[model samples]
Target: MFELTAALIVFLFPLAYSPGPGNMFFAANGARFGFAATLPASVGYHVATLLVTLAIGFGFETTLQRSPILFQVIKWAGSAYVLYLAWKLFRAHAIDKVGEARPAGMWGGAVLLLLNPKAYVIIALMFSQFLEVAASSGEVIAVGWISSVFTLNNLVAFTVWTLVGGQIAGLFRDEAQAHLLNRVFGSVLALVALWMMFG
Candidate 1:
C-alpha cells in the first residue's frame, strides 16, 4: 500500500505542483489581498474537487463520455469565468490599497471547480492510472482515498504559491512595482485561461 501511495504521490507531483488555474487564482488573490482572504476560495475548490472526483470515480465518467457537449459547455463557461477573473486581477488594487477590492468567495471557488472541464479530465485520468495500478496490486483503494490525496496535494501547492506571491508582493515598497506585479500575475492567469479554453 505504501509503495502504491508513493507511486501515486509521484504521479501527482507535477500535476498538483505546477502552476495551474486553481493555484494561480489563489496566488493572484494572495498578491492582491492576502493568504487569509483566499482561504474560503480554497475551501470551496477542494470541497468541490472531493465531490466531483468521487463522482467521476464512482461512474460519472460514463455520463461525461456519453455527452461530450456537456463537457464542452463546462469548459467554455469555466474559461469565461477565468477570463473575467483575469480582467479583475489586471485592475486589482495594490497591496497598500487592498481595501478597495474584495477577494473571491467560497461560491466562486466551488463554481469554478464545478464548471472546469480540465479538472474533470484530470480526475478521470487519475482514476484510470491509479486504479489500474491498484488492480495490479490485488488491493482495492477507494476513490475517497485517491481524492483526499489529490486534494491535500493541491492545498499544499496552493498554500505555497499564495505565500510566495504574498511575500514577493511584500518586498515591493513602491506602489508602482506592486501594481506591476499584480498585472504580471493577471497576465499569467489570462494565459492560463486561454490555455484552458483553447489550448
Candidate 2:
C-alpha cells in the first residue's frame, strides 16, 4: 500500500500546502499573536478535520452532492464570517497585551471547518477520487487512513504558514512597521474571504 499512500500524498500536497482558509487563518493569527498562541485553534481545526473528513468519506458525500443550494448558503455564511474576522484584524492594535487582540481560538477554528465550502468540496473530491472510483477493498480502514493523512498534512502546512507569518512579524522593528504588517495581513485575509465568496 505504499503506492496508495504515495498517491494520496501526491494528491493532497497541493491542496494542503496552498494558501487556503486554514493556512491563511493560522497565518494571520500567527502574525498578530504568536505561534504558541495559535495552538488552540490549530488543534481544534485539525481534530475537526479528521472527524468531518471521515464523516464525509463514510456517508455525507451524497448529501452534499444532492443539495447544491445548501453549499451556496454555507459558502456565503462562511465568507461573511471570514470577512468579519478580517474587519477585526483591520482594527487591531499594533502592540497589545495578550487577549486584547485575541486569536480565533478553538470555537472559531471549529466554526470555520463547518462553514468553509472549500473544505467540504475538497474532502468530497478526495473521497470520490480515492475511495469511490478506485474501489478500495477495505473502505472503513481506507477512510480512516485517508482522514488521518489529510489531518496530518494540513497540520504541517498550517505550522509552516504560521512560522512564516511569525517570521514576517519578527521583521517589524517599530510600532509603525507592526501596524503596517497588521494591516497587510488583514488585507490578505479580506481578499481570501472575498475569493471564497465569489471565486
For model 2, which pairs clash? Answer: none
- Please, what is the whole-model Cα lDDT of each candidate in the order they appear? 0.84, 0.84
Clash numbers, per candidate? 0, 0
Report the Cα lDDT for residue 69, model 1. Answer: 92
lDDT of 1: 0.84
lDDT of 1 at 94: 60
lDDT of 1 by residue, 76-135 (tens): 998899989898888875677847578889998898788778889999999998876666
Q: After superposition, how far is residue 11 of candidate 2 from its true place, in Å?
A: 1.1
> Cα lDDT for residue 165, model 1?
78
Superposed on all Cα atoms, the candidates' RMSDs to the truth, in angstroms, are 1.9, 1.6
Q: In model 2, which runs have C-alpha deviations exceeding 4 angstroms?
A: 96-99, 132-137
lDDT of 1 at 126: 91
Give the runs in model 1 whose Cα sits over 4 Å from its true position.
135-141
